[model samples]
Target: MSTTADQIAPAHDEHHAPRGLLRWLTTTNHKEIGTLYLVFSLTMFFVGGTMALIIRAELFQPGLQIVEPYFFNQMTTMHALVMIFGAVMPAFVGLANWLIPMMIGAPDMALPRMNNWSFWIMPFAFTLLLSTLFMDGGGPAGGWTLYPPLSLQTGAAFPFVILAIHMMGVSSVMGAINVIATILNLRAPGMTLMRMPLFVWTWLITAYLLIAVMPVLAGAVTMLLTDKYFGTSFFNAAGGGDPVMFQHIFWFFGHPEVYIMILPAFGIVSQIIPTFARKPLFGYASMVYATASIAFLSFIVWGHHMFTVGMPLAGELFFMYATMLIAVPTGVKVFNWMATMWRGSMTFETPMLFAVAFVVLFTIGGFSGLMLAIAPADFQYQDTYFVVAHFHYVLVPGAVFSIMAATYYWLPKWTGHMYDEKLGRLHFWCSAIGVNVLFFPQHFLGLAGMPRRIPDYALQFAGFNMISSIGAFLFGLSQLIFLWVVIKCIRGGEPAPAKPWEGAHGLEWTLPSPAPLHTFQTPPQIDPSEAHG
Candidate 1:
């Protein structure tokens, strides 16, 4: 067998030992903690997805058939918060936990004890959050952005929500620190930064972004809390603070928050495209630079989401152009994917299906985002169903789709069993078509003038809304098929070979299926001669 890191490295201090439950509970084993994080994020994904289903149901016919306006608002706000924080964000961290060591030839994440702490905080934090649903006034109705004044009017749960956000922030900060330490300190002697996988590179950048801006969110929300109880309003004009200032602070954190969700997707797609296509990723150096530029750009464009809240024309124009400028590098990434796929042997396994769909559908979202970048158009598009349509396209098909692709691609390696290919394809098509049906018409409705976040709409919006509702139901149900596929694959299936795909290339692929707990007890012996074979 062609040897990789796990086989070549010598066993280190106790990292390879499989001990008691305390080892799992307190151990720094990257693989164990990574598994825990991924499972937790998936659990939250379903929880948040359920909340989304409720929203889709309420919007089904536009007659306010479900919960009251107050309850509906809580659902929307918490759903976004849950999906972003509990689902998408942590999933990426989970990926980092699982892949970073394998990719970089590290025995385990640096600061393994802290890694355990990071993973453990999330459930308790979200428990604090989910508990708010049963409170006197319902969860935070001010939306996930949690703009103040309206936020101040909400129930006692607001305090709980604030504290949850704080706990989550702390978890994120610790996770980021662990990731940074591992990447900088733990790489094998021969694995230079440039030699690292794109996924690792992208995640390295993302963890830094988290460390930078997450605290701003903490501080802003803390101020909101202080104003509500302490009567010192940072956002209340009556208390001598400006409300718009809240928008400034929130979005300052908000804009980068969006890219934090997407940059890893860029890295994941970069890795998958080249591996499936049997080529080196086109412009790897450029892709790294592009990810950085996008992160840098994120800080300046927070106002794009807040244009309707009233900024001067100069403020609006500065933001509009800055926001639009994101397309250049993003376009570079899309082109790289196409170029990788342009003239190569490719197969449509479950992972490839999801990856390919991610390419097409996520671009559609990007185009909608481009349209939204127009200052004149945004005045109309802000806070409408079109915005909803745009992000879902990017996120569901973008980040979430990429995550699914990563799962299917690597499940064989993780579980040592090949997933059902036919079932996988079926899952892809059902989800692809269902997502479009669910959200595509939303673009039309928003263009035809339908506001988002309202319980009801006028009669003219009825037909399309009904169609979207049906689509939402199907989309929701199709995911169960996905759940079934994952469960079946993990429990039993045909065994998978090391380097399962002929076209696959990477350090991780060199390891056996069902990778051992301490396989990379020491770094692999690398030689340029052996790589070509």
Candidate 2:
């Protein structure tokens, strides 16, 4: 049967006739890489969340219930590694892969083959990590921070840990480079920086951060490795290399790492809030300035994480003030969102529910972060369950929630089918309530002096631990609702329209459900994607 322009694609898939696993394995298409990144990320999410469950289960009764302290530490370390690199970062990169080209009016990523390589390497990197469990000594237990001294003594897996970190960093750098090239060099003529989507703008900034810092991470971990094996002391205290010097280097990369995680969420909220509220984004200029300011501030304030590390009062004061400055730009973003929704029609689709929640909850995370930034108070709060609670709130609600919201908001566009609205709401409510229950009590535990990263906690921490564990299980199980909704939509659902959401904007929305393989092959308008049918 010869195919013709009038012929419908098999199974009505967006990527027609990508037969067998080869389609996935050898693929260079932006959408396919995006799908790979997303599916890989979702898989890691469960895996990481399961590690969290085990941690909570151990803490359920105050005594270790599941594993030895060493193994438990490994669990926490790998949980963070998998979540940050294997899960959240990949999720946003996946978003960039799928949406960036369309949003910016580029035909595809600047380097398509490199995109596939970048995504494919992640699975292998994590494989090396998980394999460490069976190694002679076990995995890195220095936490995902991978701080030295403790990192020095790990067995067979320690080197693998360094290598895996390097691999992940390499993959990220490649992805970022491609993004930078695409956004800067490939946008349609007259698509000035201001008119580009905030998502694009944020990603452009984020990709630059990745390029700059992944190398720092690379250098730090490389130094750690050589110090362990080759007898170098880039971070070795004995060789007049201060261990705290390594902290400065690691966190210099680490703090911007935080902004890297949340910046895309900012872009996403910018897109979602406007559609549901039927309003233009308020303070767009301020939003961009605020985001850039935060990124700039992020570079200088890496020292706040080291408040307890015994820096001089001068250093402490400088870092504290630098960290506090971040609150201003963050506040600008928060206020902009509120003003966007201040006087407009708003709908509570699954996406909007999550976006609105992200604003409230991420702000809470930011406040907690600001408090932590205060050096003196941190002497009390450092290493407590309070810090644990704060980040999980930021991460789970902030990053993961944004990913889920994006899935729901764009599922129709991707699959040409509407997700079950009822199931979507159920997923939202269950996950939301369950998440709060899981994390909130830890705040009290932290305030009460429960130190973090210990395999077990003191007996007095028992009551709250039990409640948190129950919430953990519930929250873990609630995600299945999301999985089900996505699966059901992909397999079969009611047809979707070109512009499924009434107030949707941008080029992606202009395409029919199940976006085509090649779109806007020739730029049409001054800002090509803004070109209407």
Candidate 3:
């Protein structure tokens, strides 16, 4: 087995890759496809972020200042859709595509053609969804959840949104399949299941979750399509269908989908904490078990999201306890991260800053989640700004922060140049402060009896809304600094060694900075002592 850095392909294979735009279109290379995924995700991030700024801008003042209420609804609906499916999910998948093969010491993803197809589907799917905004009835104003009846009321946008969702689902399922296949079959000699990096481990579990639930969402949306156009009544109360049943099916997919987004973040933090702490991860096997436990609990706790929908007392109690039970494993993970850092020679690079912030802030999100888990408490919090605050805390600082951490941690390796550290820290601070200010006041607004998804609020909610809007602008603007950091690093910077971070571990670190287009054509031998559990 070879332990060498990725090497350029032999001269005979050089011409096989097409030049320029054709290279991107026809390439089956994992690294190139991964770059494509990252670039697309960045584009969508701004697209969705623009929608969010519009929402914040409208709510910056008291009443109907910027856009009409219907347009506001479209912004809310499309913002959630674009962020969840287009921005966050694709970012994780992009990371998977770039790092998974390298981590496992495989040359490329298993089923390369499927990988290419999976990525190409996204731009078209999103285009179809976004095109609806220009149509007669405007884009989906029914919210990202696409709850029935209201969703059924959507005009020309109905079929387009549904079809776009189906296409996104199909793309995700295929990407998940490719991930599972690559991880399961393409590991190098001695890279056993447990020996694989935590990033790889979390993605493996996430892929399984995707396989299980994406189809459920696909089915639910298909039912919606049928109910709307074909006179079926899967969720139409007029035809004897139960709208509550739609909530059940949707949440069944929705709760696990939440974990699907965050679980990869968990893997990333698990990797970074140990690296910066200059220690092998603490309780490595326990972390793996804890991740699996959280995944298992995710399926059972979907009912909590629907506690206010008039579930029977017994059902409500069942969901409440099940939801609370997740805190146990999550607590384990948090404890392990702290323990990993306990008394170690810890450093606070940009990546470490984000990872540490993920722990504290995401814990805040989790505690609020616990608050929501209590069935009786949920009755107050549901459909309120508190719920908005809770999830944004989880997502923006939790998952999105982890993605940023990963970019900083690996950018040196990816670009073979060290980024400007000072700028990176500035981006992190602005993001951290801005996110809290943006979200913390929303918690107060929810407690003050403010509802979510409304464009305008009563005069009483004005001050906190103003503060939240300011934070939104600050947070949104901070990302430009991040964009600048990435671009600058790509063009020119201090040249990096193969292993830029002294504490970093894994097969990826073993490869050179700016790893070659093709890597590990001969499998690398794994050293048990160096395995990142």
Candidate 4:
């Protein structure tokens, strides 16, 4: 039963990848590592999603029903940590591992061993973080921000959380470094930086963001550890330290961290929109500048997140204006996507459906973010479900939708089989409807005065909470269909052609379907006209 892929191999597969358990443990193949990262991220997605379901179940009714209050808090805390660290970040890294070398016309990553180590470090780190739940006092319940005083109250679990975070940071930094080096050094003869795909460009910038902010996060957490155990009082009020200082520092890294999660997503949507729209991306050079502009603005806008803290009027105005300025570049992106689709031969495949939804829905999220940017308005929105709704809108639909789009766009190439399109659309509808139903209610609930991260709420807020919970359940179940689609495609279907999507253009697509274990061993020559600018 050896398949067709076995009958045809790319130039670099002169030596076959080893098979079985030892292969995964000992190998340095980028594709294998990418598969590992993707699989692991999906597992973590379910794990994190289950935690979210538990929280929603508890909030389904007015009072506590499913879990104890302490455990509920732990669920909320662990859910965010898992989704951000375990799920989202790893998924992007996985995409990078799979596509970067191929797109850049390189045999493999420049620092292959470091890439392997970076991914391997994740399991141990998350294991340590998750194991904290079994400790005497439960997991870190101070929210993912790990703010002081409340953060210091996590009993035996605090130190472990800090260590886990530090380890994850190390893994991120390593992955970022590998990406930077590989892209800088490994392009083919004519594949200049400006001509590289948007996905690669976005990742190049994202790696720098990671390298810059991960260490700041490590330092922030380490300082928190010292404040808790070593009595350093970096954030201790009694020791003449301002807790607000931690807010300043945390958001400094935190704002860029938000971009870190979404920038690759921007890259993804940029790639998909054009392919489905049957056009070269509009305003290619402006798109690059816009992405770079957004990254640079990310550093200055950290203060927007903390406008509710008692800052001076000048500081408030500066942060508010700076935050709003991000809309300019972001608007450039949204407009370019629209322009790309304006007059083109458009097809609404599953990936396009999601990308289209991302543009509209993610724009809603961005709008809400702008509203939150106003220092005066933030007073009303801060700490409310509005803030929760704002971010989930961005991350879930914004980042998660792009990931779905990428999965569908590339799955055929990855597996050499076409996924069920009918089922794919079904999954998209369920997700699109479910996501709106889930978060859209929260905006109303927040404006009506429901605070976030609460275990229980008053009867006044009960209806929307119930609606949100039902939506959460539906949305959660929809992902099972995605899992089925992925597995079914991987097992086999109609064999895919080398370039399954007719309009698709990239170095990777030039290779065989289910791209060979080794690709671009002898860097391909790129024609200046054929490549992107």
Each model's C-alpha lDDT?
0.85, 0.87, 0.92, 0.90
- In the range 393-414, model 3's lDDT, one tens digit per residue, is 9999999999999989988988
Q: How many clashes in candidate 3?
A: 0
Clashes of each: 2, 0, 0, 0
- When 1 and 4 are scored with TM-score, the better candidate is 4
* lDDT value, residue 429 of candidate 1: 91
lDDT of 4 at 123: 94
All candidates: TM-score: 0.95, 0.95, 0.97, 0.97
Candidate 4 lDDT = 0.90
Positional deviation of 492 in candidate 3, in angstroms? 1.1
Candidate structures ordered by lDDT, highest first: 3, 4, 2, 1
Give candidate 4 regions above 4 Å deviation: 1-18
Q: Which is the leading candidate under TM-score? A: 3
Which residue runs of candidate 3 sit more than 4 Å off their true CA positions? 1-12
In angstroms, the error of model 3 at 532 is: 1.3
Question: Which digits, one per residue and each the tens of the lDDT, describe model 1 over residues 15-99?
Answer: 5555787766765567778888888888898999898889888888868798788888888998899999999999999889988
Clash pairs, model 2 backbone: none
lDDT value for model 3: 0.92
Residues 1-533 of candidate 2 have per-residue lDDT tens digits of 12211122122344564778988997777887899999999999999988988888888897767899998999999999999999999999999999988776777777877888899899999999889988988888889988888788888899899899999999999999989987887786667788888888889889989998999999999999998999888778788777888889999999999899999999898888988998878888888889899888889999899999888999999999999999998899989889989988998999999999999988888888888988999999999999998998889889899899999998898888999999999999998899898999989999999999997778898899899989999899999999999999999999999888897777778677888776656653554434211
